[model samples]
Target: MNLQVLQQLGMSERDITLYLALFQLGPSSIRDIASHTGINRGTTYEALKQMAARGLISYAPKGKRRFFRAEEPDKLLELAEEKRASLEQTIDSLKTEIIPGLHHLKPEFSSGNVRFYEGDDGIEFVLKDILATVGKLEEKTYSVFSTKSIRHHLYRPFPNYTAQRIKQKINVRVIALGEGGEDAEYSERKWLKTDGQVDASYIAIYPPKVAMISMASENYPVATVIESPDIARAQQVVFEALWRFL
Candidate 1:
């Protein structure tokens, strides 16, 4: 069997070894398990305790001694479902309790907090941050100065970004530098003349944060997220002015 998959499902090396040994030698004692797996008796006992606690194994007394056996294979699926439900509960707690408490500790109007991200995955991180921070307010909108260069970089990593944004009901106003972008629901686009100068950079103006993405790097894509209300407002004003002119 693929032991690595058991490890991925939160089983430790000792646990996997002991479980496999138990499966092979059905209704075995601790001495038999240790002898089969070449593990020390004390460690084997501890692993058996843990596995039994997790419902992966069970034991029943046979006269003066007890024999341990692996639970039905279907129990592994039940254990995985339990882990998934636990993880969902943790995520909910972090969102409702932990994250807001941490936010409260942040200084108001602090020096521009800038974070750098690299590669395609990093670019997707920045985009997801925008979607998550905007919340679900119908009137909330953000502005963007999008270029063809950055679009090419982002399209592959986040092909469904626009569809996800629309699904979340977030609105955007964009100024496309150097042509060709379609109008979508909850989004407005206008073209800008690059005048034979394509900078290969994109700017997104979301309140309290402004993101600048550079697709000019030959090696990989890069993104910078600046968290400063003043800077974001300034960029928004510039985008609005250009929006009016276009």
Candidate 2:
């Protein structure tokens, strides 16, 4: 009476009952099948016709009435195998259609462009890119002003990154906003008190190619990096002027 297997083979509840009755009772007319399953004659005929079309049953005329019998149960395995073959053919056709387009999707190696990355991962990408760009420079200087959220995320990863930056001998002059008030731990430990104090804007110079200017907040965390020689010179002049006084 475990008709769950038949139900899974695309048999409806009434269809399962009729098919199980036919399966158990052997070759029989729709009337006898209906009586055996207690299904109405109309529903029994419908289920019988559908099962016949699916190769689940075979029927032929015997005298004045049609007699129906369940086809070999092995047809269920054949149906599954046929579906598998159809799926494999579909997958192979798609592979042929898509593989050639992959080469066209490849980027040209010499092409340089500004790309926008989204969300927290974008922020991480920009920050990590800054680290890589600075690591190759002979000298690096930055005046960074950060908001609370940026400060929190920075603190989480700062220890390891700070160690890496220090080993590179990349001098970073940070100027972060004293947003969480005067005696913040990030300000005391990371900020250079006199030369590198907290401010409302961020400025950083890593010799040759990069500088990050970030204004971080809950709603608008904008980190902009200027990679032009002329702008780098302008920032350096401003940073040096501020560095000299402090």
Candidate 3:
């Protein structure tokens, strides 16, 4: 049987070996158990002590010597249940005490900041963050400079992002830098010159934030989120001017 599962349940390898050895050898002495499991005597003795403390093993004194034997296999299941209960209690304590303490430790800043995210998962995080932060009001809208290359990277992983936005009734205005993304409900799209003039970068303006996503590199997808209201407003102004011209 695979004893790695026991290790995952928090029993050490030496403890597992010693326990199994005891189970097979039926109340053997420490030296015999160590020899049977190919573990050193000192380490075997220490593991037996710890396992006995956990009720996985027991010892009996016979004259001047001691013999160790494994408890019934049912005890292993009981130990596992106890561990699970202890872990649930620890999680509750962390949620109530540690997490709130850490949240209060975060410093507040006045000026806006920039955060960078990389890889496909990181890009998904950015998209989810946007969805969570933006309000659900009908008048709320965001603008984007969408490009085919970035969309190719994004849509494969997050196929339902636009659908989710539409479901949430969030409106978007998009300026396409190249060809081929359809305009869905609750969105407006305008195209720019598509004759290989634009690179594979996307910019989004959502009031207090401007996100620049780049998919041009061979390494990984990258995104930079700037949380400056002044910069976002400037980008929105430029986008509106170009929108009118187009």
Candidate 4:
């Protein structure tokens, strides 16, 4: 049976078995249900107690013993709907109140920060950082050192990066290590000749941060972001010196 719905409803595996057992053996005592479900009696009772709290099952007195039965299956749907509404409220609170309050608790000054990410998703975050960090600057510009080897993989995670950059009016200056880099609006490109194939790598110097992306063993994409104004400025200086030379 596809029990994904039950799992999504936050039902544990033991609870699922006990719940179905209750369905098959209606109005049964705890001992009968435990024997039928093969779960220990104590665990079975605990599961039933929690399930009852969620309105999944209920019990009443029958002669000398209590008999348990599964509530209407539709109760599961109601529980799910309630969870959805709660989640929406939580998200709103996070956006409106929680996040800003937490930010205030963070340190005012950081000498350095470094983060590492792996695979396509990681590279996408690095690209997003480039846009978010640079877009806020007075210059709204950054520089890139890209190699032809990594050209294909660089934008694979973010094919629309250039379009988004253009929309944001963010400008880039690219120094292509080998041939084969495209030009886009609000961008300047200059190439440097190389004798042999260079390793797949990309570097972006956005003020207050520098992002590096490259292919590791087995062609896995990896990225590192360093948030240091001093380091960023030094790298920017090197890039500008090379830009003027080329």
Query: Which candidate number would show the highest TM-score if scored against the true structure?
Result: 1
Q: Residue 10 deviation, candidate 1, in Å?
A: 4.3
Give the per-residue lDDT digits (tens) of candidate 1, residues 1-246.
Answer: 577688767899889988888888999988889999999989999889988898899999988878999999898988888888999999999999999999888887555488999998998899998898775435668888888766778756888999989998899998999977778999999998878858777888888899999864664888999998899989988888888998
Q: What does the lDDT read for residue 123 in candidate 3? A: 86
What C-alpha RMSD separates each model from the true structure? 4.1, 12.6, 5.7, 5.4
Question: Judged by lDDT against the true structure, how good is candidate 1?
Answer: 0.86
Write model 4 residue lDDT over 1-246, tens digit each, in one string.
787568988998899999988888888999999999899989999999999998899999999988999999999889999999999999999999999998787665553378899988898889998899888899899999999989778788899999999999999999999898888899999999999988888999998999998888656899888887789999999999999999
Every model's TM-score: 0.71, 0.40, 0.66, 0.67
1 or 3, greater by lDDT: 1
TM-score attained by model 4:
0.67
- Higher-scoring candidate on TM-score, 1 or 3: 1
Full-model lDDT for every candidate: 0.86, 0.61, 0.83, 0.90
Looking at model 1, report the run of 10 residues with the lowest lDDT sum. Answer: 132-141
Model 3, range 1-246, lDDT digits (tens) per residue? 898799866798777778788878999898899899899989888888988898889999988889998888998899788889999999999999999998677555333367888888878888876776675434668899988776778755577899888888888899998787886999999988776757678887887788888874764788999887789889999999999999
- Estimate the lDDT of model 3: 0.83
| Candidate 4 Cα errors over 4 Å, as ranges | 116-143, 149-174, 181-201, 205-209, 213-223, 228-246
Q: Alpha carbon lDDT of residue 29, candidate 4?
A: 98
Put down candidate 2 lDDT per residue, 109-219, tens digits, no spaces.
Answer: 222322443444555666667678766655553444343435544424334655565565555555434434234222221333333444333444544444343445543
Q: Report the Cα lDDT for residue 120, model 2.
A: 48
Q: What is the lDDT of residue 75 in candidate 1?
A: 89
